[model samples]
Target: MEAAPTPTLLLAPMEGLLDFVLRDVLTRVGGVDRCVCEFIRVTGSLLPDKVFYRFIPELRNGSRTLAGVPVRAQLLGSDPSSMADNAARLAELGAEGIDLNFGCPARTVNRHGGGAAMLREPERIAAVVAAVRRAVPAHLPVSAKMRLGYDDPGSAMQCALAMQDGGACEVVVHARTKADGYRPPAYWERIAPLRQALRVPVVANGEIWNLQDAQRCRALSGGDALMLGRGMVADPGLALAIRAADAGGQGEEAPVEVRWQALAPQLARFWHLVCKDLDPPQRAGRLKQWLNLLRRRHPQAQAAFDQVRVMTDQRAITLWLQQLVAAAATADGQAPADPAA
Candidate 1:
């Protein structure tokens, strides 16, 4: 039998979320080929060295992830020169690849002519990619991530073509138009045409919520790679499951109880990391975001999350979380007693 192809699964970089702790957890879960860091915003003339370090701290000692998987530094900006300068700084700091963000749908980002708005002018998109390509080392790859278009699907082909023409190694296309705002029924079929139109590799993104969705996306886009976002949050083991399924390996869906039990420790770790860096109220808010996802997976998670949600005191929250974990263990039949009850 011929050897099976290596699956290409990338972790999407979500701003204000998917921070270092989450990245570390997901990277160790296996099956993710690469992960992109959150976009480092570029607003002015100079690209500071500190900003590069803030986003890609692994550069401090030439580390990638603990698993040795590569992480790319993603940049969001409208200025070609500034983008190029930042890309150069990232290269100097040891980034294996640089990804340009042209798919961000946030109102604030688009209002500034950054993100998907860059697609409005194909010439500018081409210029930015070309400038960044020229500024980075010849061997270091530069890529672009984009949505179908601002309001329609028409500009995707043009924008992708421009990026390819400007020397981008690959372009990842999120199948929804900016107006869609992550609604259901992502138009994966739209990416197939763009794949046909561009010379560079085309990666399909958006609405790939499960292994089935990943399979459908591959069939629809006719592309080899995928970039996952919200899907991973709902189920962190999704990438691994997809790869296993593709390889004809039997994989079990992590039972709801098992998933919650596993996540308790990760949540504890994330809480500690956030408390060390943020104020009480800020830390609580971040914890709440994870709780929201946790609750979706296991309704009983809300009981545990409630113990920490309102407490601004880190010690109080930590204790509450410990009690919650104990309660979850008892509920899972893995321990002796329900401490909360």
Candidate 2:
């Protein structure tokens, strides 16, 4: 039998969690093929270019992560014209690609008629995507991501068709609907119809937290590609593991222990970036957010988070993280099972 093609692995765009700093860290870790910028809110008159830069500063750097992985700028809104206008401006600013977010389920965004809330109006999704597709250069890839639906899980097919009608080259379907709201039972099976129905590539999302989940998702969703969000955040090595599996090996080929060892410096870099952009309190909070997520996958991260969660100052938090890392690194450079491991 002919060998199966390699699956495309994308880093899902996360709002507050996966900012430029985390994007840099994850992309630099390697294996993630592409990333989407945190959803940029387009409200009222065309947002100044600076706004896109603030959310996706990599635009100024050729829309690439530090490791040169491409980063697409994602816009969120209900206005077709404004979204189209903003997409045009981003393209002008050297954005590598454009991703429209129809999958965000945050109450704040939904209240404003953006994100997953737009999924409820399939026609509007088509119109907005069509407008943006017209605005961007034909050569530049345009894509959109949405959950199954607003309240009904059955709306996925309609939403996928809307994206195709609007000229989207690819569509990612998060297995659940807006009503699901990050709940358990991600509905991976629901992506099958979207994959079968859409002429374009259908990328699966939601509930892929590990290698086992990735296998199940592909089988259930009938998709050759995946966009991982919290899965990537909680376990930074997730993309590498998934890539390993896609290549016909168990994802465990890359030892998670060594992955954590290499990841320590990246956390330090994240702290530095947070300190530079945010005040002291925000800095600690940002680090804490990552730590909390990492804790779900690594005990070392849990210990680190416990040590600094109450600390209010950036410098002190930096000192704590650095010392912990220093102690973790050994003569042979293998990660220890505790803080360093």
lDDT of each: 0.80, 0.85
Q: Write the per-residue lDDT of candidate 2 for residues 118-178, one digit (tens) a residue.
A: 9888999999999999999999999999899999987778888999999999998888888
Runs in model 1 with CA error above 4 Å? 61-63, 255-258, 324-341
Highest TM-score: which candidate? 2
Model 2 ranges with Cα > 4 A deviation: 1-4, 253-258, 334-341
Least accurate stretch of 10 residues (summed lDDT) in model 2? Answer: 332-341
* Clash list (residue pairs), candidate 2: 336-341
- Going through the candidates in the order shown, the clash numbers are 0, 1
